[model samples]
Target: MKRVLLSAFSLLMCMSASAGVTFNPDKVKAVYIVRFANFIHWPQESSLKQINYCVIGNNQVTNLLESILVQHQVRNIPVVFRQVNNQEELDDCQLVYLTPESCRLGELKIDRLGLVTVSDERAFSESMGMVEFREKSGRIVPVINVDNVAKNNITIRSQLLRISKIISTPQGVEHD
Candidate 1:
């Protein structure tokens, strides 16, 4: 397990180093989110036969994720990447990486979807998505909203939550 963690970390570093000025930290962070998926446990009878990582807009994150996934397998399943043009496509993904541009599709009702949605926008409130990634002290970390995750039926591992910077919901509401 340590070896896998080390390998994953090494891959993350290499990706960050290789990312040019055009690459956004959010994109790099999105790649980290993809790595976290490996540690999660989905429902046993999930219709998803493969682990799908979808990017909602044109970004370097998909390329970075592809390169990293090529070297490693998640839960013994091959990781696949897809670029989504619409909400219909998003439904097929296990994790959806949404750019600021894609967030405008609020009418798509993505917040209520079962797939995990990740973004960099601070405007993403508790009702907007499950988790948001932020850059702190030169490192990217996830700010998970457990309530939203539970609403979507996504199971996040305790270990991942321990390291994450959790974002709390409104008063009187508890997160799973």
Candidate 2:
């Protein structure tokens, strides 16, 4: 299983080697988001027949997500893309992408239950987002906030955690 995940991770990274046009950063992030669906499990009660992947930023990632509607999926559910203008609308989203500005507010009104919040801010992993992307050695590395993820009632598979740069240490807090 670890080998398969590692291979998949390698494939995803290879698929984004070229810069925008050939390999867009937003598209890369979009791919990561889609890949996330494969490993991040929401509670059964919170899982939906249709998952709305939203973005608070008006960036290329938004456009990239649209392309995955045809390439990726979650169980029997359909994957979709949406532009969110406010937190209230976030309730309908399973995954929400926040820009630096949106994450900066630090007072996201969106409910944490079953939601995967991703950001690109430096302190995003330490503060608000469950997952974050940062440039490291010329590559975009993902950092996860394990504590916060559980706080929001989201479950992350260990395989994903093994591959990600988890920012949150075990706090002696148990998770279900």
Candidate closest to the true structure, highest TM-score: 2
Residue pairs in candidate 1 whose N, alpha carbon or C atoms collide under 3 angstroms:
none
TM-score of 2: 0.79
> Model 1: per-residue lDDT, tens digit, 1-176?
43765675656545543355243574457457667775565653255567777877765665676555654457666567777788788767777777767777676667644577777766463556777776776567677887777777778888878767776566324334
What's the CA error at residue 134 for candidate 2, in Å?
A: 1.0
The 10 consecutive residues of candidate 1 with the worst lDDT sum are 14-23
In candidate 2, what residue range of length 10 has the lowest lDDT sum? Answer: 167-176
Q: Write down the lDDT of every candidate, Cα atoms only.
A: 0.67, 0.72
**Model 1 quality (TM-score):** 0.76
lDDT score for candidate 1 against the true structure? 0.67
Top lDDT model = 2
